[model samples]
Target: MFECFLEIGFEAELNTKEDPELMEIAYEQCKENVATRATAITELRKMIFARGECHPLRTDDEYLLRFLRAREFIVPRAHKLMVRYCTFREQNKHLYEGVDLWGLVKVKDAYEGTMLDRPDTGRLSVFRFGRWDPNEFPVEDLVRAGMAMTEIGLRQPKLQILAGTVIVDLEGISYRHVATLTPTVAYQIVCLMGVAIPGRIKGVHIINYSWILNTFFYLFKKFIPQEAWQYIHFHGSDLKSLHKHLDLEVLPERYGGTYRGVSSFGIWLNKIKKYRDEQFDREMKQLGYVIKE
Candidate 1:
């Protein structure tokens, strides 16, 4: 059974929670080139499935629109990103194998506590990554866990086709943890977080990043393009400084803020673990390959 913790108001506008003007940056391009991009998305959807290697549901207008928003409505860029996302899934078979959801949790585990904690800021999906022991789980499982949450998050009303914020708490990560990010793994992560996923990722806050964190970001930086990379924010241990940008009330107790709900990580884990079966089925259908459950 899935034990839900916090219930957020998904109806809140991004303008109210975040800087109203900055919100335009996410969809300004789409608004400017609406007709052309929409047409291209329609055509590309048909072209992609023609090869008989895609999910019809993923090609739906609302679903594909998220990718367009992520790419600022640039058809080619959006198409390339979609293709890359599908390719990444194709390359990894373990994602669809036995107990992937629980496997991901047991290995690369985490959930969007930021959402449940701050119901008003549900649009900003924040996750804590300090506890993820990279030595036990490779980058593949990392991507699996991230993508699994993304899929589940989309089930929320407006989140289906909207971009959201991503906050990663980097408290306990060490040199050995950062060393695990190889070029291949780095590229995979960038594609998933930066390009592949439809969400605009209005901002990526790396809070509590330690001095040693710079080395990891240095290696991780090469894979991300400048435009998307520019949104990445580094906030050291200063909770007040980080709260200045991200609403202080939206944070958890660790950062000197309160959750106002069931503040247990296990409750958040169940929220994501419930989606494991659907994600595996999704991979099986998207790649045109069948995996016996």
Candidate 2:
């Protein structure tokens, strides 16, 4: 239904979904051309196989391109991120199970750090904060849930090539919230978000933020790479700025937008349903990962 609302007005500089011209721009900016893609794949495969393992998305042309574009098509950068993404999934089998299981979503639902529904025009995504129960779920669980959301986003053809945004709504974060964010954990999260995934982060908007939580900002600044940190925006409860940057065409009215009735979880469930249980199982098997849940 939101698709009915048009006249984007080049307001969104990165319109990967409808404009081949913009997509071409992304390819150029990322140095992602036909020749470079082929070369990267060849080099990436050789490196992956040398590690005595298989990359699940190795032969997936789209998957490789997404990574290449995310890393600006630099062979070394893309390969490093590619390997890290695949290997991390392989190593952390328990974090992600089959799509049928929906264990990650279940955990997120229980813990209250839920991923918001509907992506913006740029395919930017959002997740809720403040509702999270750290004692019950912890940062690792949040990361797992985030990964599952990323996987779901990546499966959608339009989103794979486009970058994403995350809006963290902080109602009243306290010292305990800051306590959970250490440099090491922050670094892992930064890597998972910035690289090691098909969905690259275009921006991270932290809204409804409390000044008291400033103590934890340093962890992100210190751990998250400088280049990546530039994308991080602290709205400090500025809804208008957040809405403008995200473009309300895609945001639900609840978040200061016009779009209405976007089911918080149903859209994601539909995407996951399209992915199917068996396909996820097969991918897990290829990665030599077991369904922990």
Q: Which candidate is the best by lDDT?
A: 2
lDDT value, residue 12 of candidate 2? 22
TM-score of 2: 0.72
Residues 214-293 of candidate 1: C-alpha lDDT, one tens digit per residue? 78777778878878767787778777777777675666566666654322234444443343355445643453433333
164-200 per-residue lDDT for model 2 (tens digits): 6666666756777778877766766666676567567
Candidate lDDT values, in order = 0.57, 0.58
| Candidate 1 Cα lDDT to native | 0.57
* Highest TM-score against the true fold, candidate: 2
Runs of candidate 2 with Cα error greater than 4 angstroms are 1-31, 34-36, 47-62, 86-94, 97-101, 107-121, 261-277, 285-293
* lDDT, residue 62, model 1: 57
Give the C-alpha miss distance for residue 229 in model 1, angstroms.
3.0
| Model 1 TM-score (2 dp) | 0.69
- Give all TM-scores, in the order shown: 0.69, 0.72
